[model samples]
Target: MQTMKLTIAGKGEGDDAPLVEDLIGQLGDFLGLLREVEDAVAEPGEENEIVWRVTGATRNSPLSIEITAFPKRHGMNIDQRERKVRAAAAHGLAEIKRAPARPDWFDDRALTKAGGIFGRVSNGLAATTIDFGNDLPPVVITSETARAAAANIVRIQKPVDRPYRELGSVEGYFEGFERDGFGRLVLRLRARLTNETAKCILQGQAAAAFEERSVGEVIERGRRLVVSGTLHHRGPGRLYQVDADRLQLLRNSGLPDVADITDPGFTGGLRSEDFLAGMRDAGSA
Candidate 1:
């Protein structure tokens, strides 16, 4: 709680400062006891401190005791701090009863970890919620809590099926290439089908062939070319590239054409110029 004002019965005629200081000293003793209780009950890394505001004391006949509390950084669970304050308050009240001369009138406000002391004024005591600062609300996630959430998430397995088939000469525009850690080149291309365009990846020897024919021209200019190879697989989605081997580029000079070549199956080591001509003829027929 940022500020707690207690109505300590002061010897009205005497110096009010000394009386407030004495009451503050007594409160500090109570805090020491509260600390012990907190240490036993609170989780590790939790901390708290007490402060007496000397200037906050009333100069008038009836004195006011103002004290403040500050807790160390913690997780988002604000309720924990509120619980600690309640426990501390209960403990402090118990100690006050043991005092030989307890304050005739006092404030019993429910202090919060976020520096808030809230209560309605009753019997000459002005208690209310104290707003310390504009700090945003906390994100409550302990290590254990995070681990539990992770454990509850569902995982999907990757699909696997492999039986090589002829994918014939596929026509597409070259996008780019990336060499993996294993020294194997990966070619990314936009394969234009009869009805739709598919993003394709040519790996290993097929990718090497394209690199050799183009002299890595595709990597620099990103040209559109025709590639012929054996289709290893179509992958999970039909949109996946037809994994091919023994690949050959049909048209290395970035050209867009409506080469009507139906799934001509796997064309291992086929020449691009001849394949393009045959496909063009087939389209005419």
Candidate 2:
């Protein structure tokens, strides 16, 4: 468990307190920043669930709220994880304060979510500060600092295009089954190598094979599946979908590797290379 303090200082109307809407907006952005940071720092396959509570509040001139964040799951190293989360939160805030300058650790998504903090200052949020205890200095965002940070966030360059490419075969847990708006079944697979969820769209034989098993059987057991398809992605580690032409359940003793297969009529008598080339040409057409 760890405690942090958030203080919002400004003059509103005739009082030395910030506006209610401004205060609420800042608080929301602050929570969002922490959540993004937590997600960015979490290890693969490990979900960090933090429960935040308002432990105390001060009615002083500059309203200050004490928030305690603790992990929901119990473990031997809970304290260590809490500390790491706190540190990450502090680091994320620091990066935001130095905005227009690239973040040293946070990804684009995290930076985008936290970037709103800088814009709040222009909306009459005089100043916001986050204090993480234990000899660590608080991160303060004033009107001047916020303007600079916000400018930097706006100036950051973004990629022009994020495209999908061919990813022949991928193995992962196939879960999250639902119907799309067009009344088509969509199965989401979290790939083992990438850990990114790929929406699996079954085709031909793949669709027929999936109908053999009940949805309950597939989801409850989290069936591992090998899906050969085209992978849509923006870049490395950013897989979005898979248009699968082949889908098969993986057994304890998995199926033989492609190299071990001796079938010459794998793709209706066409050689593997020629079949793949034809598919690519069809896709481009």
Candidate 3:
């Protein structure tokens, strides 16, 4: 387990101290942002369940609230996991300081959520700081940071219609499937090489073909599929959707035990060196 602390300070004290309700609400938003960051940084099936506790509070001139985070999980490489959580926390907070411009490491969903949280948390606080200890610089959140984050959220939420372009054929493992708001079946595919995910919409014949297959079995077995379609994009590196005209299941193939093509008889009785030499001679001629 690893721990990190957050300190929220207000501008005044006594009757002038930040209201309890406001502090509580802001703290909730702060925690929500942290969770968003955690999800953004965590790889599939490797997220740590974090438990938070409010360690103490002070009624001094500048009211302060201290909260600690304890991340729990079971596995070997415990140190590496802890370091991942800590690094994620640091990176998330650092990005908060540069809001209104989304970071490449963070996805659109996380950025939108974090922006909303930052706007709320900075509403009535003097400052907020996250302490990771170990002589690392803390992350500070201020009202200005909140303003920028809010602006970025607004930009992302703005409506814009985009056209889809031909994406041809793409191969990937089937992650799962879902129905969109318009009741269209959407297939979630993770690319074979990059592991990046893409949403493929089944239409017309493609939809009918998918319905004929054992959808549940395919998903359960982690089957690979090839989708030939047109694609839509929100921005660079962000693939919004694919309108698939063709969908086919891909079969797994294993390496052959022997190189049959390398045999002379298989190559028209020509040796490998002779074949290469003939090709070189032809090219030079």
Q: How does each model score on lDDT?
A: 0.40, 0.70, 0.63
Which has the higher lDDT value, candidate number 1 or candidate number 3?
A: 3
Poorest 10 consecutive residues of model 2 by lDDT? Answer: 153-162
Clashing pairs in 3: none
Candidates, ranked, TM-score = 3, 2, 1
Each prediction's RMSD to truth:
25.4, 11.2, 7.8
Candidate 3: tens digits of C-alpha lDDT, residues 152-197: 6555445243544657777667888889999998998875533458
In the range 163-201, model 2's lDDT, one tens digit per residue, is 759768887776677778876667888766444578988
lDDT of 3 at 40: 47
Against the true structure, candidate 2 reaches a TM-score of: 0.53
TM-score of 1: 0.26
Say which candidate scores most in lDDT.
2
Write one digit per residue (lDDT tens) for candidate 1, span 1-285.
334444434333454232444445434543443344444343323344332233365645445545554434433344455455444445433323233111111121111111111111111122222222133222222223323322221110122444335556665556666666776666665543321234345666766676677565555443545555554443322234555564544444323344634444545456777778888999999
* Backbone clash count, each prediction separately: 3, 1, 0
